[model samples]
Target: MKIALVGIGKIAVDQHIPAINDSPDWELAATVSRHGSVDGVDAFTDLGDMLDARPDIRVVSLCLPPVPRFAYAMQALAAGRHVMLEKPPGATLAECHALTAKAQADGLSLYATWHSRQADMVAAAKEWLTDKRLTRLHVTWKEDVRRWHPGQDWIWEPGGLGVFDPGINALSIVTDILPHPIHVTGATLKVPENRQTPIAVNLEFHHPQGAQVTADFDWRQEGDQIWMIEAETEAGTLTLTDGGATLKINGERSGTAAPLGGEYPRLYAQMAQLIADGGIDMDLRPMTLVADAYTLGRRETVAPFHD
Candidate 1:
C-alpha cells in the first residue's frame, strides 16, 4: 500500500523511512514536512496539500511529536485514510480518544504505535512472566538527553514529557508483559528550574497482587546508557535490558539478541496488519501511567538544565 510519511525528523529518517522502504507491504509514496524531506520522493511543506494532491496514498503515517499529532491524525482520518501515530499518540488523552472515535466512525484504521512493545525479547519476557507469581518489578531508564535529543527545545516545554519521553517506552513494556494490572500510588518528579517538564522522576505503583513496582527515569546519565527492567516472581527473576532487545533469566541471558531497528520494522508490519484487518489498536496503558505520574508526583525544583 502507498503511505505518506508526515514528519521527516530524526526518527523518521533513521527508523521510519528505512522500515517502510524495507517492508514489502508499504511504499514511500510521499512525505509532508516543513524542513526535511526524503530523497527521490514527493515532498510537501503542508499536510493538506499532500492529502489533496494524492488520494492514492491511503495510509498516512505520522512521525510528528505528540503535541501536533492529533491534528494531523484527525485530518488524515477526515480524508478517509488509515492513520498511524507514533508513540504516546497525542499530547492529551482526550485527543487520543477523539481520534479513535473519529477513526471508528469513518471506518478507517487508527494505530497508536508503541515501537518498544515490538522489541524482540518483549514477547519472550511476557511469555515467561505470564504464569509466574510476581513479587517485584523495577525499571531503571536513564540517558543523556543532550546526546539523544540535543537542542530539542520542545522537549523542555509543557506537554513535551521531558524524561517521560523515553521513560514511557519502559512503561509500554511493563504494561504489556505483566499479568496483573497496576496503577500509580506515588511519584517524585525532578523538574529543572527553568523547564516545565521533569528531567528525572521516581515512580511508585500499586500492583493488584501486592507486588512492589517502581521506576526511575533520569535524562542526566553520562556514560553507558541504561534501559533495563527487572521482574521478580516466585519462579525466578526475568530481566529485560537494552530496551527489550536482550533478555536474562536469573542473571543468565535467555533470548537471542535482535538487531537495532527490529522494533520499527515490526511496527510497520503491525500497521499493515491493522489496516488489512480493519482494526484499531490504540493502546493507552503506557500513556496512562505517565499521565498518572504527572498527576500524583510531587515536584522538586532541581538545578537548571542547559540544552
Candidate 2:
C-alpha cells in the first residue's frame, strides 16, 4: 500500500513516518505539511496539492491535531482514498461517526487508530483480566507539559483537548483492556485561570458488573513522569506501565517471545490486516468517554498557568 502522511508535526516525524517506512505493507509515498517535510519523501504544501499530484497514494494517515482532522479526512474519503485517523479521531464523536458512515457507504477502509492500545503487553493484560472479578481500577497519567509539549500554542486553543490530549491515551488503553465497557458517571475539570481547557481532570466510571474506575490526569507534574493503569482483581493485581509496553501480573513481570514492536509499526500492520480483511475497525468508546466527560464534568478555576 502506498501511504501519504498528512501532517509533518512532531509526532509525524518522530513516529508515523518511521513506522510507515518500516512497514513491509506500506510505502512512504508522500507528505503534506506547511512547515515540515521528510527527507526523501514527496512533499506538498497541503493535502489538496498532495492529492492532486500523487493519485497513487491509496491510503492517507492523518497525524494532524484532532481539530483539523475531520476536514482533511472528509477530503481524503471524498477522493476515494482510504483514511486512517490518529487518536481522538475527531474533535467530537459526531464527526467521527459521520466519517465512519461515509467510509462504509463508499466502501473505503477507515481506521481510527489508538497507537497505545497496540502495545505488546496490552493484549496480555486484557487476556489476564478475562474471567476475573475486579475490585477497583485506577489510572495515573501525569507529565509536565513544559517538557513534553514545550511551547505548542494550539494545545491551549479551543478543541485542542489540553491535558486530555495525552490523557486520552490512557482512556484508549483502558477501553481496550477491560473486559466490559465503561461509562462516565462524573467528572471534574481543573482549568488554569488563563486557559480555556482543563490542565487536570478527575473522572469516575463504573462497569456493568459494578467495578469502579477512577482516572487522574494532570499535566503539571514536574518530577518523574507517570503513565500507568492497574486493576485489583479477586485473583491478583494486573498492571500495565510504560504506555502499556510492560505488564505485571501479581507483581511479576509478564513474558513474551517478541518483547516489543514499536507501537506505530504495530498499528500500521494492524491497519493493513484490517484493510485486507475488508473490515473497518475504529472504536469510538474511548472518544465517547471524553465527550461524556465534557458533557458531565464540572469546572473549577485554578491559578493562572505559565509555561
Candidate 3:
C-alpha cells in the first residue's frame, strides 16, 4: 500500500518515516510539506498537488498540528482516500467525531491512533488489571518543554494544549491499560502569565468501579524528568514507568518493558489491521475526559514561562 505522508516535522522524520520503512504493509509513496522534506522520496509543497501527482497513494498519514488536522483529513476523505491521524486528532472533540462519521459515510478507514497505547507493555498491564480489584490510580508526567519542544510557539497558544499535550499521551496509556473507563471529577490548571494554555495541571478522576485516580502534569521540571503511573489493587501494586514503556509489579520487574517490536511499527500494524477489517477506531473517551477537565478546572495564574 502507498502512503502519502502529509507532514515532515520532527516526529515524522524520527518515528513515522522509520515506521513506514519497516512496514511491509505500507510504503512512503510521497510527502507533502512546505518547509521539510524526506530524503529520496517524492516531495511536494502542497497537499493537493501531491495528491494529484501521486494517484497511487491509498492512505494519507497526517502529522500536522491539531488545529489543521481536521481540515486536511477532510480533504483526504473527499479525495477518496483512507486517513491515519496522529494523537489528539483535532483541536476540538466535535471535529474529530464528525471526521469519523464522514469517514464511515464515505466507506473509508479513519484510524485515530493513540501511539502511547502501542507501548510494549501496555497490553500486558491491561491484562494484569483485568481480574484485579483496583484501589487507587496515580499519574505523574513532567518534563522540560525547552528540551523536548524547542521553538514550538504553538504549544503556548490556546489550541496547542501545552502540558496537556504530553499529559494526553499519559492519559491515552492509562485509558487503555485500565480495565474500565475513568472520568474526571475535578481539576486544577496552572497557566503562565504570558501564555494562553496551562503550564501545569492536576486532574482528579474516578472509575465507576470505585478506583480513585489523580494525574499531575508539570512542564517546569528542570532535570530527571518523570513519566510514571501507579495502580494499587487489592492483590498487588503495578507500576508503569517511562511513559508505559516499562512495567513493574510490586517493585519486581515484569516482562516486556521494552518490547522487541517498536511502538510505531506496532502502530502501523494496527493501522493495517484497521484497514483490512474495514472500520474506524476513533475513540474520544480520553479526549472527552480532557474536555471535561477544561470545563470544570479551576485556573490559577502562575509565573510567566519563558522558552
Against the correct fold, how does model 1 do in TM-score?
Answer: 0.99
Q: Kindly list the per-residue Cα lDDT of model 1 for residues 73-183, writing each as its tens digit.
A: 999999999999988799999999999999999899999888999988999999999999999999999999999998888888878999999999999999999988899
| Tens-digit lDDT string for candidate 3 (1-307) | 9999988998898889999998899989899999998888999988888777788998999998888888899989988899999888889999998998899899999988888888887888999999999999999999999998888888888779889889999999888888788889999999999999999999999788888889999999998989999999999999998878889999998985675248889878888988899989998777888889999999999999888
RMSD of candidates 1 onward, in order: 0.6, 1.4, 1.2
* Deviation of model 1 at 42, angstroms: 0.4
Candidate 2 TM-score over all chains jointly:
0.97
Local distance difference test, each candidate: 0.94, 0.89, 0.89
Better of 2 and 3 by TM-score: 3
**Candidate with more favorable, higher TM-score: 1 or 2:** 1
Q: Write down the lDDT that model 2 would get.
A: 0.89
TM-score of 3: 0.97
Q: Model 2: per-residue lDDT, tens digit, 34-148?
A: 9988888898988988888888989999989889999999999999999999887999888998999999999999999988888889889998898899889999999999998
